[model samples]
Target: MPRHPTFTLRPLHAALCILLAGPAGAQTLPDVVVSANRQEQQSFDAPASIHAVGQDAIEAAGPRVNLSESLNRVPGITVLNRQNYAQDLQLSIRGSGARSPFGIRGARLIVDGIPATMPDGQGQASTISLPSAQRIEVLRGPLAQLYGNSAGGVVQVFTADGPERPELRMSVDAGPDGLSRYGLQAAGQSGAVNYVVDVSDFQTDGWRENSAAERQHLNAKLRWDASEQTRVTVVANVFDQPVSGDPVGLTRGQMEDDPRQAVANATLYHAGKDVAQRQLGLVLDHRLGADASVMARVYAGQRDLDNRLSIPLFVQTAPTASGGVVRLDRQYSGVGLRYSRRLPAGDGQVLFSLGLDHERMGEHRQGYINNLGVQGDLKRDEQDSVHSTGVYAQADWAINEDWSALAGLRANRVAFRVKDAFITGDNPDDSGTASFSATNPVLGITRHLSADTNLYANIGRGFETPTFTELAYRADGSGPNLGLGSASSTHAELGLKTRLTEQQRLDVALFNIASRNEIVVASSSGGRTVYANAGRTRRSGVEVTHSAQWTPEWRSLLALSTLKAQFAEAFTSSGGAVVAAGNRIPGILDRTLFAELAWQPRAWAGFTGALELVHRGSMVVNDLNEDRTDAVTLFNLRLGWQQTVGAWTLRETLRVDNLTDRAYVGSVIVNDGNKRYFEPAPGRQWGLGLTATYRF
Candidate 1:
């Protein structure tokens, strides 16, 4: 196993000291409210680790291309841009989802109160529409368990509501490497209805060989007030990506030789993917009384995908090999209902909530041999389905002036079934079914030390089931690995929230987690991977966040996280490698930092500017720790101008990323048998954006 090294951040320390010593502004920060505990409450009073990113911050970040652009401002989370449009962003929280080769697992995703993650614990971040987002909320630590299975953490996006007056807006953005985006939006409110609609087109030429992509997006929201106590809302969205090139990862040697070159097979086989998706949802809120209410939601969606992989022709000839080409048509839907009531308790009040949710997904899956990018003979066919149901109850009580308590319990059941449709003399029927169930509980307490300080503690249990992708292959090149089991975890956290002055705030949290039967990659080759289990593992970490307003025109924010994650019991991997206890987990960095400074003087009228810094520590690529990537630091800058005349508003922005033009690896593929692990980051890039809005 590789030895963990100490990290130095002298520059960051100096910056912090300077910011802390600066003169304080007179403007006071406003209070924040959150729903992380299934109930509405002040963030400072909630006994959980939760953070919110405002719309202003999001708009100032960059071109609004991906979540990785701004998520770094939050502590205890990691989101990386792989520069491969065919694949989703690589995301993890506290080391839980680092092992995923594609898409997202071990974390939950929600949009407008609708679940974006499927019942099988798989999700894609591409469906989110950042242009229309009002705010984003993130929740981590023990309190996250209340969300049911695979609750390592939660990320939720909320769309903006319509304005009182009718408005139309148009935007254009251009960047290096022939990148461009065009967008249009309309929003308004009538007698009893509110509506918002948005559409966008994005295209980019190759930054590296064989890496180009194009996409179109549409999002809409409508709300109606039936009466004084009844409300209804409808949401619809569409996503289309006609094509996205796949530039496969490179070995260290290949990256050093030429970071801009694609692997030979990528071009030879024309590796890439095509995707389309459509979804619609409805939400209802009714008030039974001033202290009681009921909420219900229903949603349905469909997704179609076609992907081509660069597997050697010889490998596809094996009797049980699935193939090099993949196709999927999936239909999914879900419904949820919740009831809440508030009652007087002691000097304050208690809020009670109970809810039930059910979801299902069915897919037609097919695999075919690839004859130089063309589909050839059929190799496999199957029907797959997953069903999940959960029931939960919670109570938050403000027992007295200085004390509060929260308790919750949840039960979940998930079932998976697959039917074989193509069978041959050499391949026997591989149909199978698997089911998992668990009950989780969480408890928390908070103490108000003074008007400006609060301390809290919490503990909970979490569970996760293997996604169908993980069950598709076995280490020995057999069929689905039904023998794989679920993983469970115990989590605890202690935190502090304090207001240092009228314009500054600080948040700190410490957390620990222990898990059994942790899922891991046994081997990966030719775009396919097999799964196994490690007996036991541990993860502990500390996170710090600070924000300050100095002299009204100067403001700063900083977030830092340090973690220690490792295997706790010795185990022999299916790849014939002996993983010793205490080996550091692969694909997870031990430390990360993000800091920013902004200057927006009142005297400057319409001009604003900011500087940002991001740092990531070294990480191993495999269980044996034979190879790793170097730590890297990046700097970014942005400037903006806004003007209004008559009934029109105009805004423009200039941005630059990776200012130093440093070469580095942004992410890795863990346990890749072919030793193709590193994905190179882009060099210095620049962008320009302009938007115009007209109101009537």
Candidate 2:
């Protein structure tokens, strides 16, 4: 269920510092700090739009849940849980990748210091392990493009590190529709080394038919202080999902007839998937001198996946068609080196950072016919590879106490190659190569208006290349659209950060972006999703956010966004109808609102209560804008209690979601040729979770 938005959410800063000193006669709030720029900086002074959500707020709603559970309220971002586990979640920022059918594309994703997003700008957050998360940082706007080969949004999930004292934690959670989760974590520091490890298992029976899922995950991190000036950190993670079912989208008629029923073909093909991933990363940090430093990070990972779709049987007979069953064996790796130096400049200080980043992904893909729950005749086979390399530099000059400037530039190159191994007489070699390159620059200025306020503005360009999947098909009777080029764009944002009162903080921003060669949906049918370049488009939006600590017992947070995304140039149709200029971009809601309130009265020791409200404006379902999802409002309530006994703490939480039990579509499959666009949201769900922690 969703409702029209009541506009909320906004924040931004520039490099160097945007310090809002604490008020007189009041305990000052600690500076909001971030490390996205390879150095510690104050949020009020950074030139980019960034937001950080801490563990308390993260778990206050639901621990170990999808990002959709916690991120809805954050400005500049949207993550929708389709409830179809096999497809994972759909996430976007500023409507950049809102039309993606599955996973995340067009932006970037990171966990700790490892690249969760590949070099090709494609990513998935299924491996985030919310139970182990200490915080999540989102970086948006033009500066995000400095990360290279992306459309300018960065989502970084950081796992909790070891504490000075040994701690052991265990948790159990259960909810309606047979949902269950069990987790364990251990962390401690000893001498020069610190370590943290977490393991969890999750399972959910479908709210709708053919949508059950089970997953097992493990994550661990170790940090060693090699010397006074050197340190080494290692991060490792493993994920396995033996059963993640796909319910597929439902036609409007089917949704009305029986929203809980699976499409006939989905059940007939045993639509589901199995996934396994393993990753390892190491970071070495060393201080060269008081004015210079170096940091290097290297990572490697692998993924194995098998999936079956609801393709029509007749389509499988086409000679060039890839069958309904898909299998992938992928290996990916990367390394990053960055150097930083600070120099004195007149009355101001200058900070400079230089870096190089490189990554590559190799994939072996195959397709076969689905024989009930088994794999059948071979149909497609190929090897796909992607490599990206970049060099970047940034300089921050604190010209004066009240004024500062930051400038950054980066040059990036990405190459894609594919080799068809299943070439036959009729399905001749469908192999080709494509390369994309771009240079992006960023500039921003911040003015300190007062001890606790600042005004900032920034402008930058963003770039993105098509993924192998998007380039795999050519709708014009050709194979692999290798000639398809990259997309480029320019954006600018003006923002303000200030303290309305000693107890309240607020941030607001207005931004606009215009782009060329924007990727758009061409069609989605017969189990093949294709993409093509739209001539041009523009997106503009406003965001506002406020956090207030009212009375010691009550805390409130509100975030809201309003956006207008439209085509700037008319484009001929891929699905037969011309897409006229000025048409609304499908899948991007016009408005969104997220609000929350928490109460922790002093009289009720160890007790807390929270209420959350999420409202989404109606979203157009396809490029043609012929249909739209109904707007609905959802309410969630949570209550929790903590108790201490003999060096141990016990905690319990209960949450009720979608209290109104409203029937609504959670997301859409944009431009589905079959016109099955809606994916129904679950109604009236409740969960109970319990945790125990021991300290030594």
Candidate 3:
């Protein structure tokens, strides 16, 4: 199950004929609006595989950055930089998600419309804090099936509200390892009330060497208008952090010149890490009388984590170490309702949504003598409770004039409970457990030819359940287990959308997915732990994107994706054929490319210059093909400045990332016998920023 030889698409058709022979300039392009099928269209008439990241590209990408490195310059993303800022931050889209050990377990993270996943879906949303974002949409396969765990897709995030005028902003940044950042923002409007506020602070002394980091943040937004069809909104967020630890599974000459000396014989609780978070929200929007509209929302969140790890043993006479430390507390609550109507047939529309989610998790563990430590006086304690409910309906039929059709369906129900305590030999041991239900489904279609072309198709179903730390994880490490159930998925897609002129725009898709009883995590021989279903799996893909404006100040964007995953049957052990049936699926990557180019000139007054290119391919790090990874390319640069002084406005930016300082390894994790790895980029950096704003 290992093969290589099949490389020639004539350099991807000569890079798409030099990007379709550049320079057809001015074609007016700026309509980009999207809520991705939950309503709000015009992303060239959205049909799926959407992408957006406005707010001026997140202020030219800066300030306590690394939202997967600004989503890896978008385009069939696959960012994996476990450079550890308190570990766990690896992302994947298009190519069947989930690469565990914290951070995304079957993708789904929505903010603003809330649903940051966690109802035993193992949620941890990468400490999001993007300067109170104003946009960030990324929907891929399965068209996300209108949320509710549509298996790998959806990362909607939209913040920043309550401002129609009056504002103040501040930003400061410094880079190159000892990075520092500061930010502040304010907004105002009075009459029917409105306000927004933000604050940030960051510090780093990283790039290795005990790796240090500190963070603090606060965000708030509020709006009210009680008379014209009612409206109310409020949101608050807070975070605090401390981190110091890097060098995970090192080797490559210990990450070239001291990567904290490869954990320095481990200890310090095996490299300590800490985190804290909090959130609160409420939203209501009603206009229940003119064509109909209604919305409601509620949210609450909390999280705390501490970890210590260390392991390195080779007994016979010496060389020893042992580690384990964990402390976690998580709590979340949610409520939602949505309705929209405007139907009399023809130009018809109908939408409905309902949701409820609750979660409470607490776990504690201690067992150390190396691998970092702190969080003691506990041999294990656990408590978990989860509940979920969801309902949905959709329609947007316009069956005429280019035809259109969109249909949807959603259903979900999940429940779980667990309680445990232990302190063996010192007395005390107890347990309790439960599990309830799970279901999902969705569909879509669209067609238009002209007004810039279009065509689409979709099918969906998704689900995941099993948490309480994988049903009480324990493999001689003490206790917790009480049965488990829930894991399913099926997805399909087809697509094409075009604009091709007016500065170009294009999208293309073809997809397939399948899953069943696939829960994984196994090991045996004395220290044993298990949860296996591992049967049935398949994934297929193709994605393409292009954006151009070649003149009128020059602009360009390109994207490509291709994937293939398998394992429909066949599994053996005892050192042979561990996985068969068309192998290939383990951190899937067969090709990915992203390109960006920009130059705004006309006498450089409000200037801009940019260039970016990222490429990745060749991967297969497990399922017993020994292990492999190769193929990497990266480069980035940006320079900016803008102005408008009258109502006050100013901007500045400068960036450069890994211009060339490669020594790859982006992700890997092979249990028990260990085989870590993670660090594919970061080395060669530069940043500078400034911003100011005011209006009205």
Candidate 4:
């Protein structure tokens, strides 16, 4: 076994001292984020771990094409790019949603006040509209529990507001591995209406064989001021992924031979997926009185998907076998309303918000036999539906100039129902209904120290329900598992926020979480998926992030995280294999550091350059704690230039990633029973793009 490295911050402390010696001058701080409290307030006043990535950071290297570019710099968060379009990125916060096989779970995703996470705690970012996003806010610790179910943490994306003047922008990008993208956007305001529209198309021959993908996106947002007391906003978007190839995971032997090689089954069965989705949302804000208001939103969407798996032919011919071809047609809708009331008190004021949310999802699920690339006999059919509702009350009170408090309570209930549509010839009735509910609460306190420093602590209870995919099958040959219970946990945090200098700021935090009845993947065979409740987990960690403008033309940023997550009790796998306590959790790195430096010399106007370094520690691959991937470090370089002339502006950038051409595992499929666990990342790649804009 390899020796673990000792924990120390001496290296970072020394670096901070050097940065503090820069030219002393007055500079304004960036805009404070208010999403954490669901209201507009200075970040320093919030008693939580909150961070924001603004428009300048999002477009530093040009157009925002990938979410990882912004997320990897945030503390207490992990966003891994699998480079496989068939699967969404693996995202987790403080060991929350690491075990998910596909899509995002255990976290709330919000876009323009609309819930991207479905009623059953399943989510995907296929329609994020990154190119048109103005900012993203991440909320961690107790404050996140206010979102109800699946509240591991909160990630919210806000659309860019239209400019007062009409403007149009066009851009084209190209990179290695047959990567190409085109984008166009138009924004402006006309009298009482403000509008922004963006469209993009992308295609790539991926880093690995049989991993190519093609996609297109269209997004629009509009707001109208009907009167001084009432306003309405609309948001709509569509995503179409006509081609997304799956390369599948590689075994140890296969990776050793060639890291770029595709799994044999992937090419044999032509495994891949096709998806199309469209959604629309509307929001209204009305003032009832001087100290009261109402905000409400309604949204609806539809999604169609068909995927082909790589199951062996023999497995599908068995009598009690499920098929390898899956199809889903789903329709979903939701409504949310909130009432805000404020009252003046002694030397302070109190703000309270009462909210209600309701959502429903209906899906037509079918399975078919796979004969190479052709579909064969039917295997399973069912109508699956989920209905959920939540009621919540949140408040923020400022007792005086030196103290403040925030508290919230939420009650959530979700019902899952399945209607068996294929019950012929030995296929016994497989219909059932199950419900799960939880009551979550959060409390936080903030102590204002000096003028520019604060200390805070918070604690909360959170819960999560199984996704529809987790309840599709049972291991005891009894069809669907309807008795699965919800998972619950408690989270605690202590943090310090301070402004060290006019141009620098720092945040440090410590957190712990203990969970019970955690759900884990049990077993999978013949395309049937099953899950079971397992051992408890204890996770503790420390996170820090620092940002500074070292000099007039130089800037630096740093983020570091150290985490220890392990099982708290001995358990057994679904295959009857014993798993001991103290096993490190799979799918997360124990430690990570990200550092960046940028130089924009005044000598050369309109020119900027940056260098980034990233490091990730080794991580276990499965429950046995017998296999792990090696640690890896990478370097990236970026350069850009901007100029404005009369009525036109031009910008261009070049980016080089993985400059060392390192070979590493990007992510792991948690607890794969077949022992296939490794997913190799791209070696090296580069991209260059230019944007031209017109103002009228």
Evaluated with lDDT, which candidate comes out highest?
Answer: 1
Give each model's whole-structure lDDT: 0.87, 0.85, 0.66, 0.84
- Name the lDDT of candidate 3: 0.66
State in Å the error of residue 629, model 4: 1.7
* Winner by lDDT between candidate 2 and candidate 1: 1
Off by over 4 Å in 3: 1-46, 49-70, 75-82, 90-102, 105-142, 146-206, 211-267, 272-378, 381-401, 410-430, 434-503, 506-546, 549-555, 558-595, 598-635, 638-696
Candidate 2 vs candidate 4: the TM-score winner is 4
- Show the colliding residue pairs in model 1: none
RMSD of 2: 3.8
Cα lDDT, model 4, residue 680: 80
539 Cα displacement, candidate 2 (Å): 0.6
* Best by the TM-score measure: 1
What is the per-residue lDDT of model 1 for residues 471-497, given as tens digits with 9 covering 90 to 100? 888766446787889999999999999
RMSD, every candidate, angstroms: 2.0, 3.8, 25.3, 2.1
TM-score for each prediction? 0.97, 0.96, 0.33, 0.97
TM-score leaderboard ranking: 1, 4, 2, 3
- Cα lDDT tens digits, model 3, 1-696, are 113344444686788778877668475777678887777787777777788877777778666455666665566657576656666566667654533544666667777776666766655555666887887888876657556643477777777675777688888888877888788888877888888788888888776655566878887777888879988878787877766464455543454554434456443334646788888888888988887787888888887776565533221112111125556777777777778776666554444444333434343433333322444334455566667666767666666667677767667666666555444553345455566454565677778888888888888777766665566554333345555556677888888888778778778888888877665554321112244446777878788888888778888877888777766776763234477777766666777777788889988889998888777776665555456567777678889898998988888889987687555566654232344433445556888888777776
What is the Cα-based TM-score of model 3?
0.33
Separately for all candidates shown, the number of backbone clashes (residues 3 or more apart, or on different chains) is 0, 19, 11, 0
